[model samples]
Target: MSDSTAAWVAAGVRSVIGAHTQAQDAGRTDDVVALYTPDAVLELPGMDPIEGHDALREAFKSWAPTQPQLHLVTNTVVTPGAEGEATATSDVAFLQRGESGWAVHLVGHYEDTLRRHEGGWRLHRRSTTFQ
Candidate 1:
């Protein structure tokens, strides 16, 4: 495949992470659902893999109301096939209001399986690893 095509695919997957981080920063949970595929699944170490759009959206929405500020950092590690799917990983950091001061937290390694969609690329699955 051409370098530009590869880059574009990589960028598309990377943007899903961007969208989530941006929305989190803006306290906008409504759009979080669109960050993943309709059948997307999320696996965070201690938690079960959250499946489907409705549940995932709801989970994020729960946090959205709290208005946490977040930042995401990602790297598209590879484009394995011509199907426009890729693997990427990200780091997410945020701060939330607390009794005394803002508490800072970091979630790392969002290993993702991304697929090409009508609009672009969407996250198919995410496996989170604690740092």
Candidate 2:
């Protein structure tokens, strides 16, 4: 994929993440798995890595309620990879709710593996590390 194509895919992925979370809190528990490829995986610090689109959707399900109030920040770059693929690296910040207020806030870097499929660029693997 070209740089512009990679950029669009990265933007689309983030947009879907934001939109789906918003919709989930609004009472539509529609399938979130469709946003990802079949074999996608996501790894977050202190949590087990999620494999497959179904698992990813389940992971999102667990975060549904808090998503509405949480503030999600992402800064990303998508670079072309060998063999017509691309990679996306994003700096992420998330604030989780706490009794006193939001306290479990985190800053992290996300390393994502992307490949160009018939549909477009899709995430294959994603791992994040805390700052």
Candidate 3:
């Protein structure tokens, strides 16, 4: 792929992470769900895959009360595929406030599949493996 194509794909992947962090921090479950495709699935270790936006919304609701202080996304690697599809992997660090202040709630890596949707990229599948 050309440099521009690579950059564009990378940006799209980063946008997904940015939107996710913003939505979660704002406690907008619906907005968080909107970052994925209608039929998207999210898999977390030891839990059933969260299938579809509705299920995603419910899952987010259950977790929102924790009031995460921050969600950091880093080390993103995006690989373009044919037919407007791409795969991305990134490290995610989640923090929450404790008596001592912000401490890590979770640290993980996300394996994601994204597709071009309405002139932008949207995640179709994501699997999280905690570190």
Q: Which numbered prediction scores highest in lDDT against the true structure?
A: 3
Q: Order the candidates by TM-score, highest first.
A: 3, 1, 2
Return the clash pairs for model 3, or none: none
Question: Each candidate: RMSD to true structure?
Answer: 2.4, 3.7, 1.3
The residue pairs found clashing in candidate 1 are none
Candidate 2 residue-wise lDDT, 1-131, digit = tens:
66676667667666655554455445344455554568888888888889987677767777666433543546767666676456767776666566667754777787877666566556678787998
Cα error, candidate 1, residue 86 (Å) = 0.9
lDDT of 3 by residue, 4-96 (tens): 988888888788878988888878898888888888999999999999988999999887845447878888898988878899988999888
Count clashing residue pairs per candidate.
Answer: 0, 0, 0
Measured with C-alpha atoms, the lDDT of residue 67 in candidate 1 is 38
Weakest 10 consecutive residues, lDDT, candidate 1?
67-76
lDDT of 1 at 11: 67
Deviation in angstroms for 104 in model 1?
2.8
